[model samples]
Target: MAQLSTEVYWHSTEPTEVGPPLDGDASCDVCIVGAGYTGLWAAHFLKQAEPGMSVRVVEAKFAGEGASGMNAGFVQMTAGKVLRRMLWYYGAEKAGGVYRAVARSILEIGRFCRQNGIDAQYENTGILQVATDTKQLARLELQIKRAQRAGVTSFRLLDREQAQERIGSPTVLGALKVSGALLNPYRLVRGLARVVQEQGVLLHEQTPAQTIEKVDGKWRITTPHGTITANEVIVATEAMQGAFPELYARQMPVWNYLLVTEPLTDEQLGRVPWPGREGVANSLSFSTAARLTADNRVLWAGGLWYMFGNRDTDPRHRRNDDAFDKLGASFREFFPQWRDVRFSHGNGGLISWSHSFIPQFGRTDSGMVYGHGYTGSGIAASHTGGKILRDLVLRRKTEFTELAFVTVNQPKFLPAPFGDKGGEFFIWRQRVGDRLPLLLPYKSALAPNRFFARRTGSPERATAGRSSD
Candidate 1:
């Protein structure tokens, strides 16, 4: 019922916001477009891998202005190692390769944070997957069977009491927890960007790449005020890669919202058993919570329900709105005492290629590689995607590098026409799925929710999961 504005909540005390727009031509061996997680981290990783390599990062807005800084911070690494799902779709060995690749990437993200002393406060605590009803539980069980078949031992079932005790949430039947971590996405990006810049990566903010085309010899990206010419160009904007409209066809945009409660003292947090600051996700789609930031800010993120489904000029995501209160309701359901917890509403946007429901990576053309479509769970995958892109850029042909993103591209459904108006169709389902799980709080009670499942085929159905917020 209220306007969710992202701009308002995006402000935070962090590294200096790089000012002014881009002007004058800049040249580098590698040029990255889009300052979000993918682009920013690509620059960082490239610098680390090839210290002397010249890298330039260009952004349409401030570093955190895009979906990178505006996210739910879940990093949602539980159902991770999507290789298993790929195995389901691909084969035993191929899936295993994809699985191992992502597994390595998760560890790599943690390693980067630790090695850089980023103070990301990463928690290796496992993911909690719950099922509120029989059908959903059936899905979870089916997933367990599939995962077990794939030799993924990460999923463990906890009864209602165990889940409640472990997660400090009353409305859970069982949980599947896994080793993962969470952090302030803003802090993660800002910290990593700061460190990367210190190592000599050129980062230009507030400069939109107006046109990206191939010149006589190499790739040249034109901005409103300047141009960047480089041997290689990386387009990592995900759903927001407007510079190349074809990316729009390849991916769809999904909107999610999050809320930051007034700091809960240790006494208040005592109710939650999920410690080590591990982010917790419910059995339903996209429902999750995390203890992030050094000050003990309990960040609760949820919802793929596009609050602004039909607005034209304005984007779907906005900040400091009444919708956050509805999102905070998930927290109250789990930790009832937190119901009274005052919170600041936060908004975030996502660029996802959910039609295929996969993270797209690798060379789209000669010397041009694109890494995107993390949907909303870019926290862990982007790190890997960037690494794979780097490897491909360097012409590395190892198994780990070559097979990272080969097959996930096909079977993707692109909504017809440019800027399909049916975008909210995806959001509608996610909102319904999230509320449905809660509406019917037990495994047997989930019947009413599935009644609506018959109608789901939209792009959002993939990310319509619980929000990373």
Candidate 2:
């Protein structure tokens, strides 16, 4: 096998045009931190809602340099395990409402790409959630039950034969076919940056927000090069939330790794027989996700590693050999027919994770508006979050702002040492449960309790439907 290059495959898809950083003290009606999907989408919707509003976005690096560019490109509806928790906490109505919004966002994303002439390689191919063992199958069945209770019918169950016909994986005992897509996330975010820029939003790349404060009924954000003052600010930094004092306890950054192989030969593709070319993920907490690039290279990503006190910003952790080796082994196991396929790229990045596994979108005590904590499943959800941020900033009680995730108080992780130990335990337990399901089932020890069963009223259920576009 060839040595893996420690570079993100998606970054090479196109040349990045870095915008000029904040030159001096600047002020806008709204200032956004982090130019990833959440921040950029917020800017997009904000401009659409109020065309005259002055919006500015600042990024530590170029756009999509964080999780937006580093993810496995699964435009999926799955928000980690948040849907299940939402069902437990807020019941079917609110949970279903949120799910439908995100589901719509997926189609809207494709539509936006087409309308804006952004070739993000958006494909409407549904995602396949496969089960390799009985425990995982049980998990999928449970998910289907919850989805049904939440008025979702698009998650169709497929037996082993049917699942194999879609993915050609021998280990797939059964699968849940859901509406989603696989696209180049970096391309999408960069395209979004361009669109927002054209809409008169100011984008400053290579400018990191170092200090944020609310003073005299206005928000102030200080970057390395300059300062920005605004009537409202959106802190959309996902994985880097740990850097901020107020957000540090609310989310922890966990390192997730990915490996991509060179383009497969036609014979190799023929051997796999994946006609749908859908993104596939196993039914595990720390599940492996695989997708095909436009160029036919196989991209595989999984494995979660958390550093003590959320030290994921360290550049050294971006290249994890153990994680890459395990991912390569998993690829061979899933596709033994292509056992000789060698990975060309391997990279790792941080994912902002909340304790509840659901995204938290609201303002802080300091009154700075923010939206983040997608838990590694933000592609489509961030679009929904963008609308919510717009509504929040505009002080409008739209359906987006009244969603359960926005209204309910989010659970917080323990501070510092405790959080680090708690995160480590969670990762270890989930991995063990995934590997040894018979011995240690997932919900056996980590089941939700009565404390999280409060029912918050939500908007009417979204119509029972599936993605058409």
Best by lDDT: 2
Q: TM per model?
A: 0.82, 0.92
Clash totals, every prediction: 25, 0
lDDT (Cα, tens digit) per residue for candidate 1, span 297-377: 676775544534222214544553555766766667667867666665466454464554567776654446788777667
lDDT of 2 by residue, 54-170 (tens): 999999999999999889888877542556888887788988888888988999999999999999999998888887877776676467667778887554556666678889988
Every candidate's lDDT: 0.62, 0.83
Query: How does residue 337 of candidate 2 score in lDDT?
Result: 90
Stretches of candidate 1 above 4 Å error? 1-13, 19-21, 76-85, 271-276, 286-293, 307-316, 320-322, 365-367, 411-423, 426-469
lDDT of 2: 0.83
